[model samples]
Target: MSVYTTVSRDSLQQWLQGYALGQLIDFQGIAAGITNTNYFVTTTHGRYVLTLFETLRLDELPYYLSLMSHLARHGVACPAPIADHSDRFASLLAGKPACLVSCLTGTDVSHPTAAQCRAVGEMLAQMHKAGATFPRKMHNPRGPHWWSLTAQQLYPQLPTDIAETLAEEIHFQDGHRFDHLPSGVIHADLFRDNVLLDGDSISGFIDFYYACNDILLYDIAIAVNDWARRDDGELDDELARAFLAGYQSERPLSQAERDCWPVMLRAAALRFWVSRLQDLYQPISGELTYTKDPAAFRQLLLAHRCRSEFWLG
Candidate 1:
């Protein structure tokens, strides 16, 4: 949630008048993420998050907002988009597509414990089940198609070894198919910072901008890659096992999902590696922006390549 566009107090006050929400008490920019401009807005009624779409177009927003509403209504612990007096979820703010969502109660757990990982896993499974009936259909923007294009775009700027690894991985993934696996709406960017914890229990999952329809196992792979990793970029056995146990308690993984886990893990790693490289090389300037290290995910991809055993085992 970087601050790209600045919002003045008067401007925000005028905007809030359209909503039933009371006067804006205070607001501050959030600087933890790299995507959109986010602010923690406090009003006389309650707390909410005001997000200004950076890259996502206005026409492309309904799927995300509607998915959140669908999941929240089905008992998934996620933020609910707040509509204005006119019953519209999105509006123009600072000449950008903007919306308000209820602020969930909790803090992010950076270094989560095994129990916390379990909670996240269970919640993720529930989220998947809740979103299964959602009517919208949107492709995973950072899936294989995007990866191929982004890999080509970054190849000229990357080291030879990195470029070779990316090309080889992309080629392998292009040939492999998991069409038989179950698919649904997935929170593709459920890293630690995106989930909030009240104590050891997960309060809510945030940052649904990357949500899309994809293979369910791929979503699990993305979460496992981030949530079950040790300091050395190796998968933590205890955390991985606990997480899978929790997820299976709700929605069990099919035999195909288990058999294809290794490849899915590698695919998840590649997705982040390419994105981090793009952020590092072609960064967008903002009032408060943070570009994560591309080398971190590069090391992770190499580790996944070398490790043959599934972490969940």
Candidate 2:
């Protein structure tokens, strides 16, 4: 969920049968996400996920659904978009684009271990490598350019002291001082909750709403910032080593990839920091949505800047 989507049971049922798929046996709202609302929809054939898009354009949804179908067809471990009887991937429901996706099997990991971090890194590396050939182009919403725009809109709403500092960071990015990073389709946001696990092994990844074209190293940095960092806002070397080693086992990082890790991680920190602050101050006014603390990543960015090598190793 992107903080702006909602789902209704009646509309879900209507869309399911209207698409000529089948009767929806049962559907319930999934409370774990903060962006678009989701439901685990069960039917006679099988269980599928129904997502009500909140932020994306209706025209852009085909790219998302098509990309999922393509990734699943290519053996990438993710929830594939389930097509309707007409082989249409999407249907208009209550004036919103709603689609069904194949349900991935696994439990979401709330507190991941080092081994899990390594597995996440491995799977994500494979995703990036495979996604290089994914046949669609979607611009990442949290890329530097978008970040600058977000800073402009949200900076004033932040606590007075941090606003100027964030604006300076935005100015620095605008100067083109941090623009030399390889570009590709990236997950952009891969928090531990997004990675599913069965026992000690990773089963699949979910929540592709943030997927887009951006620096590949920045993608890794997003995962590292989320998975390989300790609760005290310090990068865990053991976790980072495990993650990087597992990722390298799939696709080796270029020298450029390695050299850019620190700034990329810092950029990732800034990305989440800005987003979390936006959500914190401008929470969605709705039935059931909670705000996340921006301070988590605020402290994270401070620590990373103060001790760059903490994330370097």
The per-prediction tally of clashing pairs is 1, 5
For model 2, how does the per-residue alpha-carbon lDDT over 1-313 read when each residue is reduced to its tens digit?
A: 4424455677667677655547778877776676575778888778888887766666878877787777788777888887777788877766677788888788887667778888888888878878878888987766777778778888667777789768766665565443566677788778888888886677778888778887888888888888877777667888888888888888887776777676667788888888777777766676344667777776777666666453333
* Among all candidates shown, the one with the greatest lDDT: 1
lDDT of 2: 0.75
Q: Write the per-residue lDDT of candidate 1 for residues 101-210, one digit (tens) a residue.
A: 99999998767898999999999999999988999999887878888998888889888998998898899888788889999999999899889999987789998988
Clashing pairs in 2: 1-35, 1-36, 2-35, 2-36, 3-35
* Global lDDT scores for all candidate models: 0.88, 0.75
- TM-scores vs. true structure, each candidate: 0.92, 0.86
